[model samples]
Target chain A: MESSEAGLRPPRHRVSPRARAYWAVRASAGWLMPVAAQVIWLAADTARLGPHVAGLVLTAVVAAAHVTVMPQWRYRVHRWEATPEAVYTQSGWFNQERRIAPVSRIQTVDSERGPLEQVFRLANVTVTTASAAGPLKIHGLDRDTAQRLVDELTEGTSADRSDAT
Target chain B: MTERTEWRRLSGRMLVIHPIQELLRAWPVLIGLVFAGTAGGQSSWWSLGGAIAVIAAGMLRWFTTTYRVSAEQVQVRRGLLRRRLLTVPRDRIRTVDVTANLLHRSLGLAKVEVGTGRTDRKDDAVKLDALHVDEATRLRAELLHRTPARRETAREETATPSEVLLAAVPAAWVRYGPFTLTGLVTVGVIAGVAGRAVNEAHLDPGRLGPVSTLLERWEHAGLPAEIAALVAVLVVAVAIASTLGYVLAFYGFRLTRNTLGTLHVTRGLITTRSITIEERRLHGVEISEPLLLRAVRGARCLAITTGLRVGRGAERGGSLLLPPAPRAEAVRVGALVLGPTTPLTAPLTGHGRRAARRRYTRAVGLAALVVAALLVLSWTAGSPAWIWRLSLVLLPVAAFLAWDRARSLGHALIEATLVSRRGTLVRRRSALACEGVIGWNLRRSFFQRRAGLATLVATTAAGRQRIDVQDVPLGEALRLADEALPGLLTPFLDSADS
Candidate 1:
């Protein structure tokens, strides 16, 4: 109610310790896919080039690079702000591209948590606008922070649909 | 008020007959196969008997199937051996489209197509067949949000009279000129022959060789006379094809809006189709006059409806709100159908306008090159030579470009609404509301930049779809966006940025 009176943006950035635990759980959970694929292929033909060690290593390396690089990328990207009139997202590596869509234009907003993220109490927020272009998704947020942001944006935009469903 | 309306579920016996319906639907394929088999001398008496049995089984299945409806919902259980039941919730239905073929009209039956926007995929919309005319109307009325009405016995026998808001008999002043069905057929024949000749060059290289070899072997062969005969044939073919094409394109084009406010268009011959557009899904209505249509004081109008039927051809995608009507009549019809749209002002002159002219010239140049290529190919091949006639096609393109520029020439920005009309031949006008617009994008491609023109795309909440007006003056586009944005969100644009 207070946030509504202030017209959004009452909460400052809250560091999420739960968000980090979520990343670790997600990284390990994803290992299941490659493990399953390898088991299926190995059972089919025992002598067929054995297990693809190179592919496993490459995937791990890329994933590790992503995990290590994401925080620095996140730090560079400034905080998001959802006002009564618009939802502003400022993101970039260097040049800084700022996207501001009118709050009314925000058709849908989804907050989802994978099994690992659920374990670590982290959630991903996606803001969808009416066009073919992809939604604006921000991951690696603390559970409470994610919830609050969702509540704030949802209330601020006066969206007809609710996240309770 | 007197009619006591009621509905009952379609009979279970009907589903038992479904296999027959499936077989009947495949009758075209079966008939084609039979003709092909008989032509190849493969038909036996047993085969003939088998075909007759299959057709008889299908007819038996169709005759037994029937349905009843109620005020609340429509339930259909149809099939012969295996009955399948389908229950449709009346409230979920978005639009009910009615289609009547000659067979249906004579039989007093109509097909009802119900669109439920609940599906993520639009094509999965439900279509029910062979509803008795009264049943179809009752279903359509029920689908719409309205008070339930009791149907009387007398009302059941009479066909529902649909309210008509717009009508245009094809104008007398409009001449087909070279754009006719006959002309199309003639051109098609010549082109088909030429294409076959060219194909033969690749398919059978030995068929056509040096002229000297032909002359030496066949001294009686009048090569020049043969060539002249081909030319004469091509000229006649093109003329006839053009006439035929024009007739087919403009035949029985009627667009009507029902009192319920749904737009319906019925057109085409041989395989006719009817498309109904729900009022809520419509973005706006556009009225346009192409240079050719303009000369006859006629204009074409279209409605920007959601869920465009892709790969369905021109008639299927957007709602043709009006067949070519007199310019004044088109405006009036558009106003009635679309709810009073703003009129387009005459185009203004400046750097951007000059650039638009240059862009049109570029289009003309590209078409001229294509025409020239076709002419040269015809001359090289033993096909009919008609290069001069081909050059005349470029004239229309030039005229079309100038006229399109003249029409799309201005943009009107009224408070919270923006209306833009653009086109030379097939004109499109789009009216987008400020509240519905999700975002505004100003884009300038290399071509646009060179032409001092820019395009403004207004994205709306209905979809990521945009209303794009190309080759408009850059300053005007920006000014209109600025003005429109303020009305939608108040001074919130600045506060949101802050």
Candidate 2:
């Protein structure tokens, strides 16, 4: 490949095909809830503010908005790559917020899933910060992907800074 | 000083202070009210007699209530009908406070209260209302001595200050006044008039039988001069009683500290209370300048606490160690009592104080408009003549607020404290330590942003105290926030992600 082509090539395309397939599974699993909620609401006939035609129009507009604004789900999120710093999940398009927790700051990792999430094999990762408040949360990752990320962050590379004397 | 490293169970006798016991102790007051009303013919003989009988029964039941204490827990069993057995662990107790009533004080007793940290329902504050002064002190000491390790595994702990600099003990007390003499006199006059009005409004013709009989007896017994003398004596008695009631209800103010860290404050002549603050829980400090006291240059300093409102610190509201002292004296005395942990000074400006005053005026102006609108509506509807004069009351309040606004402008510089003065009814100089700042928010409205002004609100775990410098340079606010963050986070750095 030309030097310019190499520069534009995306960083994670080097991962195995299985890993790419895993990323697709996680992305679709996460989008299922809003899609399901929209479908149910469409058929319920519960619109109170307007005529049925108007209700249908309103519902379509809302559904379209939700689909357009769904958070990016194609990227393969990782804890850290090499230079030794702990990685954190940075999401939320509007706020563009970032949680910078080092591997050392990982007090504990709890993986949880609700009934709906479990049906689609998706899990939630809750990360606690130092103070009692302000815990970071990453939602809607494939079960296996979530486990791998937690293991990579919790057990790999950097020294256990929590045990630093 | 003795080292207290373990939680000790309260004495078994402490259970006599349980709520049921308090209900029992108040039985006499119930009986007294019934007796007084019956003798005054305010109630029927049958109803009065029934109340007396019930009070007697309740007192009898109270004598049977009891409690038990072990090394680790306290259990109390009370109530004759629906009994409750409350068991609380000693280690879980956060604070032990004491309060005194006339009966408790005369008997040399204090109500020992235990604070459980949970806010889900009410605090688990069980009052042992009749513990001896010594017992209450020992119990408080015992609770304070319990080590943090024994309670939880938290790495950070509340440590006591050593090498004491200033402690205000009860012995160094200067008479603290809540209501000035002039204020008290005005209150008495208003109260007397109100009392007479209420009596006339509630009076019944049937209830005048005793008064008629007394008048008739006096008429037959002697000279017209004697009757006139009797009336004069009665009026004088009422006036004296009203004045005395106003003063004593607001009396016995004492503020003191030990050379060590503990501060003891006791006030209220009738219902006395002594509070001991461990100091760490004192999240913020406030010094206020009320409008009336502006010319006198008097201010009151109060501490902000969690859960309880200001001054809920065992000692009634912000234990006023320095009651209405001059500016210099207030600062000196406040710093001494607050100790070295507090910044020696605050950084505020005349401009900031003026801004604060303007804010107060804005609030008062809004109140006046509402009152004026209401009065106009009432007049249009042909309401009472007195309703027209009601709006006039807002005039004095507005003038007072304006005066307060004029006086409210003053700020001082402290290396690590932000001292801001603001108020109308109560002028306060608030001192917030940089160490307690949890987060800071810099907000700029469109106008403010254009004017190069912003508000930096430092939120502590306690509450937010906004420091607004209307024409303040924006760069300064951000720099101040940046400077404040390092000190605030130092204690929590061992665990913070950053």
Candidate 3:
């Protein structure tokens, strides 16, 4: 929390509270693949494979730890703010990053909702510039908030006539 | 030139040239087909039929492809059944490359490639396969917004703006070639092809030149002697190959600033390549010296231009302002290309001891992790004890590299240029015009944050498109960003008291 306030403060606002549940479910869904592989290994139970119960146990421990810890960490780390001049975002839990793209250089602004996100009444907003360093993505926003953000970003970018590059 | 709306098919010369080119390409296959026909005692008619099919495919391309250069855009329509149309706006055209092989030259024809800086799709470029020399020159000149400038290579040796020469690599510069491993790569490619050919033909590789002698002697030679001989052979082979590659690619290299303002690069031996880069599209210059090249005091200079692809295999092809030459020469050419103020020679501000400590930690930590893994493997698998012992050598090397890498970490702002230098193995110093930077990224891993360091990246649309000054103190990173573009970061920062 202190580092989030370090030098440059964290962005002005957080995403929708429901994003916690969405991320928890998403993290669990990702953990399923490794869990499924371990389950299959345990079920197959080949003696020659040698004491493979360790694999299942290790996977369960890591998967449980990841699914429980990651969602809260991400929600705490992710923050975003947009103004007439620039868009700023702080993302990632362990490897944190802050990106600043001037409105004059913004090439496109897009908003979309996946099937799960729609069920959760959530959406994602992406603002990109011509540079290949890539887009700024803010996920787990309320659908209305995302739509408003997209519109506001569109308005800000269109008002600036400079070349994106 | 008046506005022209009509679609023009490729030069009629392709109809004649295509069949011969196709026949040449398919000769080995055709020969196999003939042999198979003879062995099977089938009619020889199918061989001629197969050859005709190859020629037909080639000739079909000539018939199907048509293009038109309008006032607003250049459009190309091609394909028999697919009917694909590629259109690029004239104003978006960044560079024009004209190429001609010996055959094309004999026929007085050239291939024109129009680049629009679009990386959205492969082969989006509009290429006219065979155009008459004069027409290609006129089109290249027009596309670049100029009358064809006189070139050492344009017959129209073709298309350069009337220009002032910037720098030309002399033939003696080829002495620097052996230091870089470009020739080894060429030899690798050649060896791969030769290996495939030998496999397919079931031929003996030993019969080729001195290879048989080496193979015969290898049975009698001791291990150390054999290694020494092998090393000597490899050294000679690589040096010879790279020298040949240097001569082939940069034989008549000339960089010129044309009257129309674009930079003109004309070079090649058997197959000539002329590339024109728009002046405004150029963001900066990068001077690179790989470790071996550094030992030899050799370096290469490249343009950080928006449209051209550089680095990897593309490094030798386009955006290269200077080939492997003396380090001083590289900087001189870098200054010449960047113009006026020479940020290329500016002294960079080094990150303090903390950044150096971080580099050592990361590098030594990585080496320790590798040793631990090897230990685990050796214990479980009962591998040779010497393996992990041998791995111990990497620890000292890693520490030395960490020291060098830390030494390389520095960034500075000189006049209007943002200079950043990094990398121990391939030390790259780039001087970017601050205006080319479109955005900024300040990143920190948990360890980096704990260490109070940030990797500040300037995201641009040119060259690699992102340049990083890694492991500077977070405060220094913020200050650099603000200084590079004074008010750009000020709006987003919250009271910069570090």
Candidate 4:
């Protein structure tokens, strides 16, 4: 076995710079859930004076650490490349994934923009095959880039007459 | 049959059956209504109105539903208020299922369910609930047999398509059924339901007639002895129940390959089910051996095709080709089903020493953690010594499992099919057609990367949707992917330097 075939190299392009802020906002929103739950729990059981304050402090520390670290890690990890032959992507900060699907097998290509993504001019491009393992979602991309990718994928998919199954 | 293209209503017998079926469905509500009626006043009026409304709706459904089969497509129109029309192109039809429960059988009716390959939306499931048995058979044959070119000549062709019986095997193979351990799940379910019923009725099971005597005996016999007796009873119960379940589910089980390029499977005792699969849609076959089944050298076979799933964990399917049978029979059937040329019996390539080491580390490491936790708990909480002592037994069991898991991991690309084998407790050897593979997923965990391995998942539309080739060397994974589909990975690969 040769070094060239040793592993899948990283995909070609990184996402937009605004994606970092967008991810930070999204991550902070996720972290808020625990804080909200803790607050409601404390309110429900005001009688429990001993552990609630300590729990709240521990939760804040964990949430803050997560909000601070996750976004930057995700921004660094997320990369995508769309070629005429295939779509290659690398995502996930800890458990990294490299997915490759031939253009012939591509069933659908869609671009979605969340409410917050609109503020950051960021979007997600989803490319799917017939398999239920699910679509390849490239998150936190510039809206224009997402649109172009979708267009290119749609064109590439259409040009091939295979059933894409 | 009525010029082949005319829109037709459901069997007239449905008019009698539908309202009865609907009324039966509303039994609990009907009981509640009856109670309300006993309370007197305007409640009786409300109950009567509700009953009438339900019956009227059921009766109305038969009139609203009408279907037409044409040369190009099958079109169905239903619902009086919504008036939705569903049209499926003739070529897109992947499977045609005809099922008849006891009531439907008694009424000489069958339900026709058509599965088009695009099964992404639940709404796309096209079914006509109650059609005449004869009509249903005719419609199924017409829908599934004819190609677009041959559709016009279907009526003229008097002789039926030739059918080669792949397996008319159920009675002779009945001995293999109990080994499947399928009814263990059913036993658990029955016990759960019984327990729930006892709880709801405020009945103490321990004080029940024979149960009270059994409890007294168990209390005197000690925990281990009591558990051993219970296990013995459960095993006997499960074996008997398993045989019964198998007979009921696979009564007169037959797999037939038709001259028209369709595979037909007809089985089930109480609720008769006949599944017609388009031969072209078939990607592969899976021969699965559950632990107990493997102990007795028994295996079951499922078809890997578009449109239907191979029902996870249930040992039930819309895709089952063979129920629990001898492993040789399963292999033979699997090979025959995949067509004559497939090397389903070909030896697989193992994932080497590193993969085995990884499996051992994960399994044994996890087991050790559990044992350590139990020991720590014994020290901290002053728990019983027996529990932590029992945890020590898990170490050898976990090592055995890891060894089995390592041995089970293998994959091979034979001809145009990619054969992958994995899992220990429920070992599955899946052979998938290369053409059916839609994509490649190279997943490398942080630990897996350090081990120079990747889990290569071949994404397909059939059976579990993805066949995992776990912990293969990165080079081997790339090579397999490249060979599986030539152009898919070649663009991204670097120039090989040995």
Using TM-score as the measure, the top candidate is 3
All candidates: CA RMSD in angstroms?
A: 11.1, 12.9, 4.3, 4.1
Cα lDDT tens digits for candidate 4, A1-165 = 457344456777999989988887888888788889989999999999669988999989988887778878888889999989899998888777888888888888888998999999999999999898747889989999999999999998899886666
Interface RMSD of each: 11.1, 13.8, 3.1, 2.0
Question: Candidate 1 on B113-151: residue-level lDDT in tens?
Answer: 765433324334455665667777766665653435533
In the range B308-375, model 2's lDDT, one tens digit per residue, is 33334442353355444455655676676555534535445554442444555565777678777778
lDDT at B228, model 3: 92
Would candidate 2 be rated incorrect, acceptable, medium or high by CAPRI criteria? incorrect
After TM-score superposition, the amount by which residue B361's alpha carbon in candidate 3 deviates from its true location, in angstroms, is: 2.4
Model 3 pairs whose backbones collide: B149-B160, B149-B161, B149-B162, B153-B157, B154-B157, B154-B158
Candidate 3: residue B257 Cα off by (Å) = 0.3
lDDT of 2 by residue, A113-145 (tens): 777667667676765533223344666667786
**Which ranking of candidates, highest lDDT first?**
4, 3, 1, 2
Q: Least accurate stretch of 10 residues (summed lDDT) in model 3 chain B? A: B146-155
TM-score-best of 1 and 2: 1
Preferred candidate (lDDT higher): 3 or 4: 4
Cand. 4 TM to true fold? 0.88
DockQ of each: 0.12, 0.03, 0.57, 0.58
lDDT of 3 by residue, B1-498 (tens): 354668888889989999999998866556555555555645446667878998999999999999898777889999998888999887788788888877788888988887666443456768889899888988888788633233333554244336888889898899988888888888888787666556535468789778888788897998888989988988899999988888988889999988666898888898778888998899999999998899999999999988776653323368888889999999998998898555888778999899999889989999999999999999999889888999999999999999999998889998788899999899999998999998888899999988888899999888888889898888888878888988777756677533
- Residue B104 of model 4: what lDDT? 94
Residue by residue across B1-498, what tens digits does model 4's lDDT show? 458789889999999888888888766556655655565667658767888899999999999999999888899999999999999988788899898988899999999998876653656668898899999998898788776577567644425678999987758788877887878888998897666555534457777789899788789998889889999999998998898888888998999998778899999899899999988899999999998888889898989999777663222478888889898888999999897545568889999999999999999999999999999999999999889899989999999999999999999999889999999999999999899888888888889978888899898987688989999999999889999898777667664211
Of candidate 4 chain B, the 10-residue stretch with the lowest lDDT total is B307-316
